[model samples]
Target: MSTTISTVALGDDIAALPRARPAPPARRRPPLKLAALWPRVRGWLLAWPVPLAVLALWQLAASYQWIPAQILPAPLTVAATFVDLFNTGELQSNTLISLQRVLFGFLTGAVLGLALGVAMGLSPLVKDYLYPTFKAFAQVPSLGWLPLLMMVVGIDEALKIILIAKSTFVPITLNTYKGLQGVPSSYIEVAKVYGFNRWQMLRRVVLPAAFPPIWNGVRYGLTHSWLALVGVELLASSEGLGFLIVYGRQLYQLDVVLAAVVVVGAVGYALDKILALIEARLLRWRRDAF
Candidate 1:
C-alpha cells in the first residue's frame, strides 16, 4: 500500500511539471531559380548562330568543289545575283506585282469570308445551304484550279489574283464560321439577361470574343495567298518570284532559282513573324488576366 501511494505521488508530480512545446517549424523559402526563367527564355532571341553557321557551311561547300556550282550555286553568286536583280529594279517590280495580287485578292476574300461566315455561323439556314459546297471547294488543291481558271481568266494578272482569292477564301470562311460558332452559350445567356439587342450582342459580345480566331484565319489566308501566287506565277506568268525561278531554270542559272527561293522563304517568314507579333499584342490582355 505504501509503495503504490508513493508511485501515484511520483506520477502526479511528473504530470504537474510543465512540458516543453515543439519549436515552431522553420519557414521554408521558395526557390530563387524560378525568377530567372524569363531571361533564359529571352535568350532564345540570340540563338541564330546555328542557322548562320549552316549558311556559312553551305556557302563554303558550293564555293569549293564539294558541290558542283552548276547544280548548287555558291552563296556569293546568289548574293551577287540578288544585288544585280535589285539594282536593275527587276526584283522590286516583280515583288510589287506579287504584293498587289496578294493584297487585292486577300482583301476581297477576307471581306467575303467574314460576311459569309458570320451569317452562316448565326443562321442554320445559311450554314445548311453553303457548307457542303464550301467544303468541296476547300478540298480541291489550289493548283488544281489553275487549269480551269486559266481557261476563263487566261495567263494574266486577273487569273493570278482570282486564284489567290480562291485560296484565301476557304480557310478564312471556315475559321471565322468556327470561331463565331464557338462562342459560349453562357455568354449568349448573359447577353440575353442583360437585355442586349441583337446588334449590340453581335458588336459587343460575338465579335470581340471571335476576333482572335478570325485573326488566325486572316493569317492563314495570307499564307495561302502567297503560295497560290507563287504557283500561278510558276505555271504560266512572265513576272513575280515564281517566274524568276522559272526564268532562272530556262537560262540554266540555278543560282537565280536558289536566290529567288531564298527570297520567297524570307518573305514568308517575315509575314509570319509580323502576324505573330500582332497576335501577341492582341492577346496581351488575355495573357495577363489568365
Candidate 2:
C-alpha cells in the first residue's frame, strides 16, 4: 500500500511539472506567388530611383534652357526625333545593316579564336611559338590597323568586317586560353584515373570546367565587335546608325544625334541582357553541383 502511494505521488509530481506549450505553431510563410514577385518588385524599386532622378534633372535643365538648346536638346525632342526616324524606316534599315555586320563578323572571329585558343592551350610548343606575336598584334588597336587594312582590303564591306573581327578575336582567344589553362589539375587527375580518353577528357571535363570564362570571352567579344562596327561605320560607311549620328552632326541636329545615341545604347543593353539570360540558363548546373 505504501509503495502504491509513492508511485502515485511520483506520477502526480511529473504531471505538475511545466509543459513546453507546443512551439507556437510555426508562423506561416507568405503565398508562393507573393514570395516570388516581391523580389522583382523590390529590385525595380531599388533600380528606378537614380534613373528617374536623372531624367527629372534633365527635363528641368532643358525646360530652363540651362544648357543651349543647340547643344543639349530636350528629352521629348529626342524622343520625337526617334519616333520620326522609326516611322520613316531609316532607323530600322540602318539598325538591321549594323546587326548583320556584327553577327557575321562575330561568328567568324569566334570560330577562329576558338580554334587557335584550343591549339595553343593544348600544346606548349604552339603557345610558345604563337603567343608572343599574338600579344604584340593585340596591343595595337583596331583603328591602328585601319589604314594598313584599307590599303590592302580597300574601303568596302571587307574592310569593316575585318576590323570588327579583329576587335572580337583578341578577347575570345585570350579568355579561352586562360580559361583552359585554369582548369584544376585535380580534375585532370580524376579523369586520368577514370581512364578517360583524350576526347572524353576534353569533351566532358575541360570544356565544362572552362565554360564560364569562355562564355565571358564570347560576351566581351560581341561587345567589342559592336563597338568596332560603330567605329568603322563612323569612319567609312554611308548607311548605319553611326552614319545617322554623322548625318545629324552634319545638319547640326542635336536631337537626331541624341536619338541615334539612345538607340545605340538601348540595343547594346538589350543584346547584353539576352547574353546574360543565355549564360544563366547554361550555368544552371553550377548551382546544383554545389
Candidate 3:
C-alpha cells in the first residue's frame, strides 16, 4: 500500500511539469539586390586614388633601394618609358590597331546578336532550334577557341577580330533573349487595350522595356571581347596592348609589362563608365517607375 502511494505521488509530480512550446516561425528578410551592389559602387569611387598611391609607394621604395630597380622600376621610369614610346609613334600605332579591331568585331557581333535574340524572342521555332545549341557553345571558354581560330584565320588580325566577335556575341544574344522573353504580361495587355497592333505593341511596349538589359549585356560583351582580344594578341601578334605585354616579357622589361597592364585596366574601366552613363540616360524611365 505504501509502494502504491509513492508511485501515485511520482505520477502527480510528472503530470504537473510544463511542456515545451514549438518555436515561432522565422521571419524572412526582404531582398536587397540594389543595396547589396552599393559596396561595389563605393569601391569604384575609391579606385582613382589607388593607382596614384601605388605610384608614390613604388617611387619611395625604389629610391630607398629596398629592391632592385630593374625588378620594379620607379613610376618615373614607367612615365619616361611611356613618353619615349609615345614620341616614337609605336604606342599610337599599336593602340590604333587594337581600337580598330575592337570596333569592327564588337559592332559586327552586337548587330548579329541583337537580330538573333529578336528572332528567338519572337519565333518559337527559332528558339527551339537555336537556343540549345547556343547553350552548348557558351560552355566553351573564349581561350579554348584560340587554336581553332588561329588554324582558320592564321594568327592574323582576322583571327583576333573573330575571337573578339565570338566573345561578344554569345552573352549579348543570351541576355537580349532573356530580356525580351521576360516582359510582363500586364504591359502586353495594356498595349492590346490601347488598340496596339503587333508592330505597335513591339515598338511602343516591348523595345523600350528590353533596351536596358540588352544594353547591359552589350557592356559585358564589350568587356569580355576586350579580354579575349588581349589574350589572342598575346599569343600571336605584332602590335596592340597584348603584344605590348608579350614584347615586354620577351625583352625582360617588367616596367613595360606593368605599364601595359595599367593601360588595359584603365581602358576597361573607361568603357564600363561610358556604358554606365549611357544606361543612366536611356533608362531614366527605370528610376521613375521603380
Candidate 4:
C-alpha cells in the first residue's frame, strides 16, 4: 500500500512538472481605422472653396448681366460649347495636334539640353565658351524668335516645333548644369575612395544626386514649351487649340473662346499634376518637410 501510494505521488508530481504551453493563439492586429482618415477627406474638400466661389460669382454675373453676354458668355453656354466640340471631335483633334507638337519639341529639346548641360558641367572650358551665349539667347522670349523663325522656317509646323524646342531648351540646360555642379563634394570623395571610374561615378553618384533638379527643369521646360506652342499657333497656324481660340474671337463667339481657354487651362493643370505624380514616385528616397 505504501509503494502504491508512493507510485501515485510520483505520477502526480510528473503531471505537475511544467510542459511547454502552446502559444496562446496569436492576438490579431486590428484592422486599420478607415474612419480616422476623415481629416484628410475634409482637407481635400476645403480645397474646392476657391474654385467654387469663382464659379458662383461667374454664374451670378452672367445672370445679372454684370458683363456683356458677348464679351463674357454664361458659364452654361461655355459648358454647352465644350460638349458640342467634344462630341464633334473638334476639340480632340486640335488638342491632339498641340500635344504632338509639344511631345516632339520637348523630346528634341530635352536630349539636346541634357547633352550640352552634361558637357558644360563636366568641362569648365565648354561652360566658359557656351554658357554666356546660351544665357544671352535665352533672354529673348520665345515669341521674339517667332518672327525670325517664320522668315527662315516659314509659317509651318517646323516653325512651331523649333520655337517650342527653344522654349524647352533654355531652362533644362541651365538646370542640368546647375544640378550636376551642386552635387556634394563628399559624394565625389566617397566615389574616389571606392576607386570608381568616370562612368561608375557619374552613374552611381552624379545622376541620382542631380535627378531632382533636372526633373524640375524638365517640368518647367514642358510648361514653357506648351505656352510657346500656343503662342506660335495663335500667331501663325491655321489649326490647333490656339487657333481655335483665335477663330472663336474672330467669329465673335465668346462661348467658343471661353471653351478653348478653359480647355487650355485644364490641359496645363493636368500635365503639371502628371509630372508632379511622377516626380513624387521617382523621389521616394528623398525625405522632406512636406
Higher-ranked by TM-score: 1 or 3: 1
lDDT of every predicted structure (CA atoms): 0.89, 0.92, 0.87, 0.93
Q: Write the per-residue lDDT of candidate 3 for residues 113-146, one digit (tens) a residue.
A: 8999999987899999999998999899888988
Please, what are the lDDT tens digits per residue for candidate 2 over residues 221-284? 9999999988998898898998999999999999999898888888888888899999999999
lDDT of 4 by residue, 185-207 (tens): 99999999999999999999999
TM-score of each: 0.82, 0.86, 0.80, 0.86
Candidate 1: tens digits of C-alpha lDDT, residues 1-290: 99999999999999999999999999999677855786776677567778899998998898677988888888888899999988999888888887888899888888888888888999999999999988988999888988898889788888887888888898899999999999998999999999999999999899889989999999999999899989889998998899999999999999889888988888888987899998999989888998
Per-residue lDDT value at 38 in model 2: 94
Give the Å error, residue 150, model 1. Answer: 1.4
Count of clashes, each model: 0, 0, 0, 0
Which segments of model 3 are wrong by more than 4 Å?
1-45, 48-53, 288-290
Candidate 2 lDDT for residue 14 = 97
> Which sequence of candidate numbers ranks them by lDDT, best first?
4, 2, 1, 3
- Global CA lDDT of candidate 3, please? 0.87
Worst 10 residues of 4 by lDDT: 281-290
Of the pair 2 and 3, which is ahead by lDDT? 2
Clashing pairs in 2: none
Candidate that beats the other on TM-score, 3 or 4, i.e. the better one: 4
